[model samples]
Target: MASSTTRPDVETAAPSARVAGRLLDSSAKLSYDPLTEVDWETPLDTDFHGASPEWSTLYGTSYWDELTEAQRKELTRHEAASVASTGIWFEMILQQLILRDVYAKDPGDDAVQWALTEIADECRHSIMFARGAKKLGAPAYRPRRVAVELGRAFKTLAFGEAAYAAILVAEEVLDVMQRDWMRDERVVPFVRTINNIHVVEESRHMKFARDETRKNLAKAGPVRRHIHAFVIAVAAYVIVTSMVNKGVYANAGLDPERALAAARSNEHHKAMMRSSCSGLMDFLASARLLTKPALAFYKRAHLI
Candidate 1:
């Protein structure tokens, strides 16, 4: 009977649903448990960097040039922890958005099931990031009050293409850096493992988000499209700005004001961000989400 059943809905399902089916299969084969995969028992190795030095915010700045090798390593470690902390913040927002989207949807649908699976993966990631930060000997780092409140509101209210595109932006920004860190020998082994796990899992999330974004945009009128395009850009700016917390500078034994200024204007970091996000910008343009209003924030964030 099951074999005889002709499901017209499956035949008519959007491309997004088809992609979700493939992702479900891929995940069943290659998903990770960060808790068991990461080496948690090893003590923090001061000799190793938490992330690749080239990914550092102040990597090529004058101040960074003056810092001793030990200070440089220490700063990178704190920066890495701050990034992880910021990631947890965004992951919470994303989980809520996905859960809201899937609420009351058919539980048996492959797309809905994949969404639930992504949420579970994020839950594991948040725990993994928390433990990783603790083991790095860094305190909890968070975004500014304004950013946190804005994120809360966005997660609660954003829907359709707006929500999925914003999710794609955050994941894309993190994915580029993680790819570099995962392969670099200078990075701590456990951190590399964490990055590797995140990279593999998030590839699925990004693919799903991209598909959903395009699918949702198909239903949007010009007015709605422009509004959500701007919203996604603002969200991008917030997420990118929050990647490394200001408190990390002081905690890393640098002058907070000077370090913050340097990082804000760091040419190397800006170039890195731009280079890494070029493909994402192309995707956004292809989706016609790169309205003039959105371009301003993209330029400001150096993600264009």
Candidate 2:
């Protein structure tokens, strides 16, 4: 009775988009709230410990001075980049604080307690980066209007935890990237001090991300939920990556294209990317967060 087609005629169904909508809805809860957890009352006496004079020698003070005014301008731009990067980190912490509030609503039995500790570390990092920028003679960075708009937009979403998770992925991946960059660069004492402080603290935060995300995924059973988490994670990564491509580099007066080129080709930068981002991908993959679809998505996004 079967012609060559013995197999039943099958209709391929379109993937359900409910998960995608839920992920976006979850992401809409992030209103950029002012961080209130930091103890501003504590003195920052150590913040002013200036970088050593020997540091100037590394960049060759005389040669550095001789660079065209444009090159000098580039340093200003780089400092601004530092601030923007740290600002993203700060926003992530703010998201975490909100997430903590949400997670508290239905706390996981094995939720990581270290989130509180990482919050303290992030606050210190925000201060350190801001101070570092000021020391380098860059103006203090105020949050951009877009940050406010996005925050307000997200705040309209009712599903807060999903929104927070989206932010978690965004912040954690960037921190992982920064930690790698700091390790590779051999700067003078002052900049080195800043990097040293951030790297040490960020390492723990990265580990915490691994553990916490693992727990979150473990609790997710439905294929739709997993897809939802993946979409949010992808969105978070996009937001962070876009920050670098947008005004962060250009505002500092550096040629964004050239600087990106330098960052990509620089041996130290490459090393850091490998150590930090590469390791993060591996960890997530090992933990089964990076399934075939996820890996394919990252590859398409140029993240892998």
- Cα lDDT of candidate 1 equals 0.92
Q: Find the candidate with the highest lDDT and give its number.
A: 1
Query: Looking at candidate 2, what is the lDDT of residue 79?
Result: 44
Q: Candidate 1: misplaced stretches above 4 Å?
A: 1-14
> C-alpha displacement of 115 in model 2, angstroms?
3.2
Q: Write the per-residue lDDT of candidate 2 for residues 251-287, one digit (tens) a residue.
A: 5454666555554444443343334456556655565
Model 1 alpha-carbon miss at residue 180, Å: 0.2
* Residue 67, candidate 2: C-alpha displacement in angstroms: 8.0
Report clashes for each candidate as comma-separated counts: 0, 3
Best by TM-score: 1
The TM-score that candidate 1 achieves is 0.95
Provide the lDDT at 150 for model 2: 58
Q: Put down candidate 1 lDDT per residue, 137-196, tens digits, no spaces.
A: 899999999999999999999999999999999999999999999999998899999999
